[model samples]
Target: MSKKAYPYVLIMPSVLFLLAFFVYPFLQVFAQAFTHSEGGLTIAHFETIFYDFNFLPSLKNTLLLALVVVPAQLCLAIGMALMISKMEKGRDTVLYVWTIPLGISDLAAGIIWLGLLDQNGFINSFLFHVGIIDEAQSWLNYQNPWAIFAAIVFAEIWRATAILLVILVSGIGLIPKEYYEAAEIFGANAWVRLWKVTLPLLRPSLQTALILRTLLAFEVFAVVMILGGSNMPVLMGEAYNWAFSYRDAGAAAAYAVVILVLSLLFTLFYLRVLRVPKEAQI
Candidate 1:
């Protein structure tokens, strides 16, 4: 090979790897969605997916979880980031403490919560021991899926909030002290300072964190499976059930396409609302 050609040869490997691993799979799924049985080319699978009873409900739940978790997490992350950034001592330790739960797998978090909230579980055992209830109340049962949803939300928030915190902290670091001091000198309280000074500057990071958290929440499966049960049925879980339990790849792929569309729409909506000026990919 020519001397100058060696660099192109070395870079070719990564380009090929991305095409083989990422581009190929995405293309295949998209292709499958268009080609179906009993029809050479059609939207049958999409129709079936949309018409399925659980499909709409699952989509609704997925959107609802994202709606609830994203704002709640962003708010909590902002507070934690502010607290961590403001502190002079133990700031490093607190940052690490926040990061510790990021290592927790979804399955592990689900199981831990299951243990705590199970009937005659730690929470109930304590309540019963303390005479808070006359009987062992089933905190997370089938009839009441909200409690299970709550557990899933808590587990998700506990495990995922740290990443958002880190994002905000990095944003906080990028902010100059002059803005904060100026706000203070103007007789602005903490809320006013946060809304008027801090949040506007934190926009890019907040936008990123929001998109990441919301997308992840849409694909919430492992935790829901482990804690909420397959019967409880979140969007991803229902997709998994269709794909694996019923061995329906066409439907599964269609569901995946639906999720992809929803995620993209959400991200675009957020970017538009935030008025992100550049189309920079992060």
Candidate 2:
């Protein structure tokens, strides 16, 4: 092959792989979402899900979860990354300990937290032993929506913040140390250096991390399923119910399309808001 064409040849496998796994399945879902069983194009499936009793609640929960979790995780991951970056000793050990949860599956993380947050679980036992409470409380009860919401949020943050941490650490590492030295020469403190140098340079990574975490948060299922059960209505859980419980493939596809569209919109928003200038390229 000619030199000019070799790069294309190298990427042909990846392009083909994406077309087969992503583009093909996306088109299939899009078709399924728009078609009726009788072989007619219809909006009935969209209407069905839109009118379902769980639809609005699930939508609200999903949006709320993403909004709450993404920002919190970003803040935490940034803090952790910053701390790790400043460490001269045991940095690798600390990072490895923090990221251990990243190796765990969503369902496994949910179950681990379930054992801690269950009514007669470790949390209650600990509190009882310490006399913090007189008896075990129903922490995951449906009647206590906030408690359930908090549990799911806590589990999600603990399990996923490591992803953002790794990204930010890599971004921070890319920044030249001379920037910090220059800031120090100008009487800038650690805080000023962070805001003026680190964060400005970290925009690309922040954008990528936020876009990824936001998309995953939108599609969160297993953690909510285990912690909140049907009491917590999330978009993915509703999609699962439509597909399996209600046996409505069209409705399920509609939900999947909605999720894909939302993820795309958020990706665009992040790219726009965090656009790195040509002159600012690091």
Candidate 3:
């Protein structure tokens, strides 16, 4: 076989795998979202989800969580990556410790946080022993939505920042050391070098990390469900309730579509904003 034909032949299995799994399932869900049970196409499923009492709150919570978590994780990851990049010793050890959370499943992480933040959990127990509170406080409850939100945000940051850090650290390693030397010779301080040399060259990695983290943020479910329950509604949680609790597949598909659209929009936004010129690429 010709070389070009051989390349396509090798990729044929992957192409078929995608068609059988991702593309096929996506098309089915999309069709289910837009079609009526009676036969004809209709927007009834969309309308049902849109008019549901929980819809607005779910959308707001999802957006707010993504807005808060993504930026916080990004900032923390960047700081950690820079620190690791500059470390003269035990870098691998530090990186291994930091990335331990990546091995943890989302539900497991949520459950772990729940054990800490529950009314009778470690935080309240510690506070009680220290005479800070007379009793175990109900932090993850409907009475205090803000506390629940905070717990979820904290859990997410703890669990996912390593993802961004690993990506950024790899990107930083690719950068030529001579660039920093030149910047230093020109009287650039560490902060100035970071801004001028590191960030500009790191745009490609930033775009990748942001887009990935943002998409996962939009689909956050297990952590929110574990930490907030019905006290704080989120898109993915609502979708699960509709699909399982309410037994409404169409509404669930509609919610999935909304999530897909949001992911696409933010992905496009990052692509546009962090567009790295070909000339600037390493």
Candidate 4:
């Protein structure tokens, strides 16, 4: 290959990989969303999902979950990352312990929390033993929607906050120490340093982490499935029900397309809001 053509030759494999995995699947989902069993184009699937009893609730629950969980995770991750950043000894050990949940799958984390929160599980058992409750509580029951929702939120945050932490920690590490020294020399407090120096410099990483986490939050399925089942409606859970339980491929594809659109929208929003100038980036 000519010198100028060598770069394209090197990139050919990546271009082919994206087309096969991402581009093709995306187009297929879009096609299926509009295609009917007879192979004619139709809006029946979209109409069906819109009219379904579960559609609004599922969308609301999914949005509420992300709205609640993402902010909570961001706050927790920031505090955790800041603390870890300040540590002079055993920082690696502390971070490793905190990130252990990252090694667990979503379903596995749900199951673990389930054992603790279930009626006959550790939480209720311990509470009963301590006479805090006279009977085992059904915290994960469909009757207590709040409890079930809280459980899912707890599991999700516990399992996923490590991701944000890792990203933020690396971002913090990349920030020049001279900036912090100068702030300290100016008699700035920790809070001032965080607000002025740390966060401003960390915008790019924050943008990347928030976009990635928000997208994954929208696609949350396994945790909700294992924890709340059908009692707790989420977009992904509803999509699964429509596809496998109801055997409606078209409806499932519609759900998938909606998810893709929402992910793209949030991604664009983050990019726009967090647009760091090239000169400002480290």
Tens digit of lDDT per residue, candidate 2, span 129-168? 9999999988888799999999999999999999999999
TM-score of each: 0.89, 0.97, 0.97, 0.95
- Pairs that collide, model 1: none
lDDT of 1 by residue, 1-282 (tens): 899999999999999999999989988887777887665887888888788888877887777777777788888999999999999999999899888888888878778878888895799999999999988998677887788778878878887998899889998999899988999999999899999888888889988888888888889888778777844677888778878988877788788888889889989988998764655322
RMSD of 2: 1.2
- Model 3 vs. true fold: TM: 0.97
The C-alpha stretches of model 3 lying farther than 4 A from their native spots are none
Cα displacement (Å) at residue 11, model 3: 3.8
TM-score of 1: 0.89
Worst lDDT window (10 residues) for model 1?
Answer: 273-282
Candidate 1 vs candidate 3: which has greater TM-score? Answer: 3
The residue-by-residue lDDT of candidate 4 on 10-76, one tens digit each, is 9999999999999999899899999998999999999999999999989999999999999999999
Candidate 1 deviant stretches above 4 angstroms: 1-18, 276-282
* Model 3 lDDT per residue over 1-282, tens place: 888799899999999999999999999999999999887898999999999999999999999999999999988998999999999999999999999999999999999999998888999899999999999988787888898999999999999999899999999999999999999999999999999999989999999999999999999999999999899999999999999999999999999999999999999999999998888688
